[model samples]
Target chain A: MGIIKLCGMAGLIITGWLVGFKKSADLRFRVQRLKKLYEETEELLHRLQYEGLERDRLLLSSFSDFCLVWNGKILFNESGLTAEDAVILKEMIQKLGTGNLETEEKRLLYVLERLRQQESAAQKIAVTNGKIYQTLGTCAGIMICIFLL
Target chain B: MKEDALDAVLPFVHQSIGRVFLFLPEETKREVCELRLRRNLPVCLTLPQGIRYLFKDGTIDDRPREGVLICTAEQLEETFFLLCKRSVYAHAEELREGYLSLPNGCRAGVCGRVAPDGMVRDITSLNLRIARAVEGCADSVVSAEDGGGILIAGPPSSGKTTVLRDTVRQLSKNKRVVVIDSRGEISGGTERPLSLGVNTDVLLIRNKAKGTEMALRTMFPQTIALDETGTAEELKGVEESFHAGVQIVTTAHIGEKRELLERKITRHLLASGAISTVALLSGKIGEPPEIFSPEEL
Candidate 1:
């Protein structure tokens, strides 16, 4: 009975070791895949920003890569990226690497505001100049009438 | 950042900065910026992807496109000193100030407070304009007959130099060509000319005024090519070249063929039977080039 019990305990320990080893191998494979996906994402971002390609096909391919890595998660995750989040991630990657759209809108707004300020300043200058011109013209006309009379 | 946002924003940077900001690696950017500022060339920062876009779109060609950035007086001075080191063979005093020319025919126009001695001794400021050379543009001027003087006329940046270079290349195939490059525009030669054919010889006279006279006496060329003929003495030299049995190919800035014929000096040269053909180049570079001969217009 003792010998049989010892054999049973040994078999349990062996089974546990095999399960742990299998899990480790799976985890290693997953980590490597994730690393590859990250590198690919970086390369794609670099290429897209440097090489302006408006082709829909390339965009779709990039989107797909993001999809696989993120596992459909479109938002940030503590563990890793989710698939649905690929589109958003791809968009974010583009903005950071190239330039953000929000920043651009702000820049455009700043320019427009500046132009408005300049236009107002110009109008003020024009008004001042026009007043002087009108005064000069009126005096000249009066002088001409007096001389004629 | 969003990719769409980045894409939209990067182009503005390139437009504002006026150079390919994207494709230049970070290391290259630092080096190029230093070189540019040192040579009085302009520099700008852009996303790497934007450069790729320009390259893919054909806005930036395979050949090197020189550029300059004018931000401040200090940057301009740095660029000027660097350019002086690269191009001028003599001492700083011997070299003319306020003008910086690069190897590829791109010249920067410098403007600053001039000293009393007619030197830009102080150089308080600088305005650097980057010029680029487009090769293989001179092929259109070739005629069926070999030996005749051809006049190329155009306003600034009307692809005149591009066409002139192409014409020289074509002519260089058979004839012995000698170019008196006042600004080093025709040869597109930086250190040495890459496009000027084996038969072609170039005299880079960065300081000389009398190009035609120098070509006639010193360089025994079958054909002479030069840029910007603007004086009565230079016109006389053109006549001299004709007298010496040398075919003359030169350029001037004018509006049209009629205007060219109406000019007293041009008329004199043409009427004297020195010039046989006139090539009037119109439109910008890479567009459909329109060529007009004197007889046609």
Candidate 2:
């Protein structure tokens, strides 16, 4: 009976940790993806102006590794992202693809800065939430196990 | 005309619009010169002669067809944004010049309010001019003029660029040709399948005057070609090209030889004996070639 109860408790704790870790992993991926997008955009803009690469090819290739947006359709890397962030990110990318070079550069800098702030803030929230959810999950499992006993 | 060249713009449009557009009769596609988009207005296809409204269902309403589904603000925005590749910021040079040059060498002219800092905003209309590189039509020009700096004059859409493009190709057979393409229309780009001939070097710059100087100093070619040499600065560039011992083959937006001497700009270029021979294209574009070359006045 005691062995069975211990097995049940272990299962609960493992399930809880897995769920919490998955959530935090998604948050980290999103932040990394956003940062990659920012760096790629800056590099791509330079290639466009100095190298005269075609815009469509540059945009499509810049994010091919991330697979974030394809042919105007947004493909989010992490399932955890909200619909709103995806939409906003698409808009920023679209804006980057059009306009005069100077204005575009300025606009992209603004977007990169905005993305940076979001990344930082998201990182903080992710860290906090990850800690909270993980602890809450483990504690709940222990409480449930005690109750069963 | 390259069929796939149309693909550069197909992705941004509504499926209905593209389907209907692609379904256009071959004759319609052949003659289509411009596509106009106005917010709250029906999208239109401009032929050389008349305007036809394009319907979503792949049917065109000839001029008399009154009621049609007009373009929405959202559709216009999407199309414009797509044409700019979702970034109007990169085309700042074109935006300030009031047009965007697509990859296929087509030009989209945009109209909108200018922000305080000169940024274009609230674009309400986009006019796309489909430019193609047609080769054989200019063969007659090369055969017509023996080696000399030639100038072509005609009214708007008079195939001036067409003549220039073909003439450049023909001239490029043996001569090293450098084209100062202020707009992408002349040769599209060095990479485009649209051949300006292998011996040709193209400088796709925005300012014709500056481009002329750049070509003269660096390209080191036997001939320098450009389109629409109208401005005073452009005329100066013409003299510079002539003085450099490089033949300047270019076009002007004018009708007759007399008008060439009458217009202050053309007159200066001609009076200086800068333009050796002038080929005037009279017949409508796409019609059999009828060039009237009046000896330099």
Candidate 3:
């Protein structure tokens, strides 16, 4: 009777161990999938931004007036744009119309630089979220093992 | 004279002369007259203010300065009409009918009241195009010549005629330049040219005519210079000139070199080896002209 009880307890321990290992493996797979999705979304966003910049450049070169009006409307509609940014954009459009092409191009480069900074901040947030998700998955797996034991 | 008298006379002068130079003070009038005469503009006779009543009934019989008014199209149909009753010979109509050249080589530009066949006859509205003759405008074309037909292309107000005139001046230095002055804009010669080269011969086809025929037969110029060539027949005239071994220089309304090539007449001229070089004038007068050659393409 004593040996049988001891085997039964060992069998329960082994089953719990296997379940935790499976949960960890499942989480690892899920994390890999999430990472892939995030990468694709990030790449798509980058491409969108690149295309936007190119469009802005071409518009500025050909129809500077249209570009000014369009940029004003975009900045006004976008919630993330600050009052300072709006002012800068207005001044940039004015300068672009009255000043040389080189000056206008420099202003566009400045806008690209600001966009890059925003993108970097977003990347940092994404990385933090990824780590948090990984930690939560591990903790959940450990808790499942404890409960089963 | 009375202020009302001066007021009454001012509109007549504006209508008859297409400009109101008499309203200016003596010193100002002297300066204006000198400038106009120097530029070969039609001379206006100074009139007493009382003569205003004579022009009121459309009776151009009462001679003020010059019997004709040299006002812009805007002035004649609008503010100036209140001063005089409508006459049978509306100066604006005469302009649209394609006669009556204004001083300064400007023909009164007319619009409104098109004929059923889409002809712009009977102009109810007028815009007096102020044509200023800029000497030495065609100087660039003379130096860059390779003895082929030349085209002066530009958007409106980009000084196409000014460049063509200067070219005539330069071409006249060596070659005899026969100018087909369709609108009198090129030479600004009312009866005769006030200023241009001594050697340059001008055939004032003052109103619209067949440019190529006019150039070939009447003028028979060794090198022909004219403004705004647009028709296939005109292109044929140019081809005829080429066949006759006469060099031609003319202006056309266009923006780019590619556009010139795309135009039927210009393209024909290019493809047929009639035009060897095209000088593209970019920008207005007073600014240094930018000349584009075919090699620069």
Number of the predicted model whose DockQ against the real structure is largest: 2
Query: Between the candidate structures 2 and 3, which one is better when assessed by TM-score?
Result: 2
TM-score of each: 0.48, 0.80, 0.46
- Tens-digit lDDT track of model 1 for A75-108: 3332332343233344443332122223423433
Q: What local distance difference test score does each model get?
A: 0.51, 0.74, 0.52
Candidate 3 lDDT (Cα, whole model)? Answer: 0.52
| Per-residue lDDT of candidate 2, residues B1-297 (tens digit) | 647455555665555456667666777776777778888888888776778888755567775355554777888888877776665556666777788776666778889897665666798998887777777887766776756678888887778887888889988899999988876888775445367888999888888999989888887988999998889999998898888788889888887657877899878877665676777777375664555444536
For residue B189, give model 2's deviation from the true position in Å: 3.0
**DockQ, cand. 3:** 0.00
| Error of model 2, residue B81, in angstroms | 1.4
- The TM-score each candidate achieves on chain A is 0.36, 0.81, 0.31
* TM-score, model 1 to reference: 0.48
B1-297, model 1: which lDDT tens digit per residue? Answer: 312212222222224333444554444332221112222333432222222112321233223344334335554444444444321222133234555554445444455555554445444433333333345455556753347888787766566666677677778888888888876656755553447667788887753347667767777888887776667777777778888998888777877667787887777767767777777766443554455545565
Locate the minimum summed-lDDT window of 10 residues in model 2 chain B: B288-297
Give the candidate number with the greatest TM-score.
2
Q: Predictions ranked by DockQ, top down?
A: 2, 1, 3
